[model samples]
Target: MTYFVYILETMNNKTLKYNLLVKQFKNNIYTYSLYMLRNRMDADDATQEVLIRIWNNIDKFNYSAAKSYIMRITHNLCIDFLRKRNLLINRELEITEDIEESFGDESTESNPYLVMQMKIATQKIKEAIEKLPENLKSVFVLYEMQGMKYIEISKALEIPINNVKVNLFRARKKLQEELKIYESE
Candidate 1:
């Protein structure tokens, strides 16, 4: 059963609207938090906190760039959570490079050995990213992985465009240097 208010929009209507918004951005928030926090629990908590922030600030949402606005809120919430959690990996992430995880029991669809090798390479990439400082990591995550433009990142992070560009440049250089070991293998 559904209830409707006589007013233009009811409380239920507001709930539905926010629910839709959450559905649209939930995955993005979780993924960003996961990469930043490197822990499922913290990522989940950050996503919930960000969603709560969105709910509380629904009226303040900028209709023009709602996606960016929501993402900005998410980014802020995630960074805050990370800072509170000692700004370091409190829990070790159990990244699996197992052959079975890459290839199922049947293993007929793909080569298990190649899949395992790829998983190892992927783990190394994650390790390199994790080595980045918080500032560079945030910028790298937004520009490289999240695909935000420099201006958008600047707005979201409340930093200048030039700073965003500089951080991204430094981050890329650091990553290149850190991952150079793989090239020799």
Candidate 2:
């Protein structure tokens, strides 16, 4: 009878621990997975896999450094998935600025022509971002589009914060130069 009680208590503790970890890591896992996979279906699969891995191996995770550990797992899983699927479309520049223009906030309401120009500008920006190196591209995508912080990106990539800043700086500069060329045309 004492053994049975011990087993139940142990199981309950594990369940509680898992629930807490899930709550803490869920959003970061989902967002990072989605950012890397770039497709809803693949991201969904990756999210499920990440959650399962984290849950089953939560004991191995250090509470003091939990976020970095989870992000590393997510990053590695994404890379593996990309490698296995051969799905990293290198510099494809597939996003159209017009798509973003259509969903613009109130600034474009006064002038349809201005909105068109803005769309063209945005499209050029998208193309330039697509043209960035893989490392720079990932940083830009995570920080700018996905709204992740420099610290999170640094942790996920295992790169220095200075490197993240430099890459992001270069990405913005290159994109602005590209947009300038578009405007001059």
Highest TM-score against the true fold, candidate: 1
lDDT of 1 by residue, 1-185 (tens): 12221221344466776876777678878877777787777888888888888889877665446557767887777778877877566456544433336445535667868766776777777777867877788889878887888887888778899998899999999998889976776
Taking all chains together, the TM-score of candidate 2 against the true structure is 0.61
Each model's lDDT comes to 0.74, 0.71
Residue 64 lDDT (model 1):
47
Q: Tell me the lDDT of model 2 at 101.
A: 47
Candidate 1 Cα errors over 4 Å, as ranges = 1-12, 89-91, 94-108, 182-185
Pairs clashing in candidate 1?
Answer: none
TM for every model, in the order presented, reads: 0.78, 0.61
